[model samples]
Target: MPRRPLLRNLALTAQTVGEHVTDDPVLLALQVSRRLPRAVSERAAGLLTRARGAGVVRALGHEMRGEREAALAALEARRGSPVHRADAALGLGRPDLTAALLEAVAPDERGAGWSAAAARLAAHRGDLEEAARLAARHPRNRHLARRMAGERDTFRGVAPSLPTKTGHTPAPGRVLHVLTNSLPHTGSGYAQRSHSILASLRDGGFEVEAVTRPGYPVQIGVPWAAERDVVDGIAYQRLLPARLAQGQAARLQQHAELLAAHVRRTRPALLHTTTHFTNAVAVEAVARAFGIPWVYEVRGQLADTWAAVRGPEALESERYRLFQEREAEAARRADGVVTLGEGMRDRLLAAGVAEDAVVLCPNAVGGAFTAEPEDRDVARARLGWDVPEDAFVVGTVSSLVDYEGLDTLLRAAALLAPRCPELRVHIAGDGVARPGLQALAGRLGIAHLCSFPGRVARADARWHHAALDAFIVPRRDLPVTRSVTPMKTVEASATGRPVVASDLPALAELVDHGRTGLLVPAEDPAALADALARLAADPAERARLGAAGRQWALATRTWEANARRYRELYARLGVTAPVR
Candidate 1:
């Protein structure tokens, strides 16, 4: 909702297109000469002109099976005018045209937006190598595209368009999903993580059911249903309370009782609960009574998360000690531990959990992200951004947190502003830090250059990624960040933009310095500024890093790949695979 962010988004999209055409005087002349209505503002017309004048029109025209001649004619008609031929090409699926436009644009300037188009084109041609290679270059659109390409290339002619519901062998068995916080509202990390896994498990041929938090609100006027709603061909129990409990614990008890009764009736082979809060523990007690195997997925190191939120003073108190002890007990006793990253695995190992019992399973999105040519114009117009297309844009799509290093990045931006006059900084997600960040930017005399797009839809986050010349993860060095894996890093890498990040341990593993991104010392604004400047100044370096990062994600970080790892772990536990 922040005006700065919306304007920033617009600026980024224009900048993305501009990076490719800025150096081409012919293209520039063509763009500016188009005798279109003066009502068409310089910012809006420039974006459309870049898209058309750049190579996408021919590519999209061919793909759409439209008259390439006619499209070309339209483009030529606006040769010196502000026309939207590139937008038309995008609508028509002209990969060649799009690619032509994007060919000269380095990933740093075009960022994820440009690379995603190329990757999709490669995927359509059944070229897994090209798709995987391209997917690796962009940070935002990695997982889904890579999965499709890999599967198609690996299992082509041997397997169906989709992975078989039932593999050669039937799936191990039913895995019930317990949703303690199932409300659509308050979509915290835990909800997204659980939902993604539920889909993956069901797709991987595990019978799945969900019991929502007791007294949880329904999506609409209708109460939640426990029916055969197909989730990857597996049943889902979408339970919502008609009227429910008072406190958090009380709500958990009611949900547990409901789940206990459901388990008695359904007799699932395994009950997997998500998060460290009351939902899983309550259900674990019931599952124990039922003599069923129960698994817990820890999204974060609870003790660390608590400490991060509460500070050291609280950790020294007896209350905090008890809280830590309880979490440790839960983790110790769980049948198996599923975690977000290697950091959590290390934490569990230190906590005396059996190494074999812990699994590294991070959260992810499903489905490939493809760019729509029409999206370029519509999104640009909607956001009202008009910076000349030739600017260097760096962006981050996350809630503004002190831990996220927005403050550090702001300082870095201030430092780099003098040297990189065309550099623009975008902060997409909003949180408690907004006012202070605004104030800081103003004080730094760089308020005019910062774009704060407040909170954005998860789906919309991609556009923010697409608009950037590079994406950043500015997490401060802290115990929590060191032990935690950020979702944005995964999202950013998948999009194919070069990443500039703190040299935190978890991020260190994810971002290979000089390859995927530049890793700066934590909390060092100068280092961050330098890294950003390096990418901004060198187009080739940004492309190299972005391309390398995208490839790594496709090869190693897809949800399907991660799910397979989890499946192998479940097999070790002797859980039978469910029917497809």
Candidate 2:
């Protein structure tokens, strides 16, 4: 094989192995380099002696270390490389420099990288047409261009406007939601939250509609249906094409066009989308076409979430930068912005969104959670926990993902095992990290104390919370975790269970430290263990905290309350519907 292809394959293999084996980027890179043929390795080392070559590697290394300025400096040193120049310029917020460098590169040489960078620059500069044009140059980016256009008029001519309400009392104007995924397919927190929001909106007297993107629930194959179906009383219109062979951009265009047709047929007053920039892009196009305002509900900083999983270097990756820029652009363009918590709102404000434009509609409780709390012993028995009747069960019902810090919980459990011999830890939920967490539990000698009952059905969510004497949110201190308020914590509180969570800003917003729940220092097993031990030792304190938490959740964190907030926000944006 040729050197470039061989090196590329080696790099990919190294990355795959590194991800599966360890978290160290330097080690991963070294492993990749070591796998190269001796001659190739020597040549690679030689290139590093050159300023431009050294600059390239240094930039990547600095980015991985979260050293933004250092990465820029390294990129600056690589003046001969147009790609590095563009990246450095973009990082410094100099779109003029970025565009110049991008334009200087040949189209073929530029490939998808230059196209993506130029498209992002154009979007950042508010040249949606130019952005779309540039994005269309690459197969992977075509979807982004359509999203940038968002039904807005270009040289391509104007899009059709949605029919407006004729009467003062128009039949509750429909609000169509664009989603990445929804119920009867995926069971992630994002999907559940979308279902809750949509249900609440429907019950609030508005005709709410949802359309999921293509290739959803990719893990399970389900036949596509274009016709609208009423699932659990909420109407979902499926728009995914039966056969999708076109590139992502073309698919996005198709989605927008189809959604536009749906909008005309439904004549919704506005559009709404959540989480990702891709969803916003598609909705923006359709909304713009119809001249309808749209709302952008940011559930989490997905870029940060992705970076946290990959490593620090991934934060400064081009993809991460583009994701952030796109999200910022969407937030800037949307008529309203809704986020899950104050921490997320602060981020939006810092990103230049007006304070008044952002609404803090937190995750909330409904369904079984709102019903009277179930007895702990009864709930535990129902879940088939073979524990002593007097044993203290400390557990959490959450997706067993890495950032969730379940390993920390296992470590904490180990520390508390000897002190609180009757302590049992139940982790209810399944994810990629389950095997690793289970292994960690065994290594900590708390495997006997820890129980992984896999994913609990949504219907059984309340019971899962009920079974726990105390719930825990042991999320590590990552930018994403710090900004996101976990719905699990709120749900646990609503179930009248005291929460033991990491002392992060988002959690602090929900759990009133010593009042509603105990807040321990993040990533510190000792602190976590101490808090759990304290809660385990005092039943009266647990009851007191749980009662206060339940009252707080009832007062502030109900889906009804969240719906009301959305209603008020919509009204402010001139979308009015009569109260039922």
Clashes of 1: 44
Write candidate 1's Cα lDDT for 1-580 as tens digits: 1112233334334433443243122333333333223244334434543464544433222222213354455443434212234333333334455455556455466555455555555543435456557656755655434444443332221211111122122224877777755424435556555666766766787766676654332322223233224434434454433334432344455666666667767677777776664555676677666666678777765546555644455456433454455556667778887887887788778878788888887655445432221233344445666665667878788877667878888899899999999988889876545545766787789889998766777657766776778888888777888988877776677667788889988888788998898889999999899888888889889878877877777777767777797678677666767544
| Tens-digit lDDT string for candidate 2 (268-365) | 88889997776777788777666678999999998788677655655655456666777887798889999998889988999999889999999998
Clashes of each: 44, 6
lDDT of each: 0.61, 0.74
- Show where candidate 2 strays beyond 4 Å: 1-172, 217-220, 224-227, 578-580
- Top TM-score model: 2
* Residue 304 in candidate 1, Cα distance off native in Å: 2.3
User: In the order shown, what is each candidate's alpha-carbon RMSD?
Assistant: 22.9, 12.1
Error of 2 at 174 (Å): 1.4
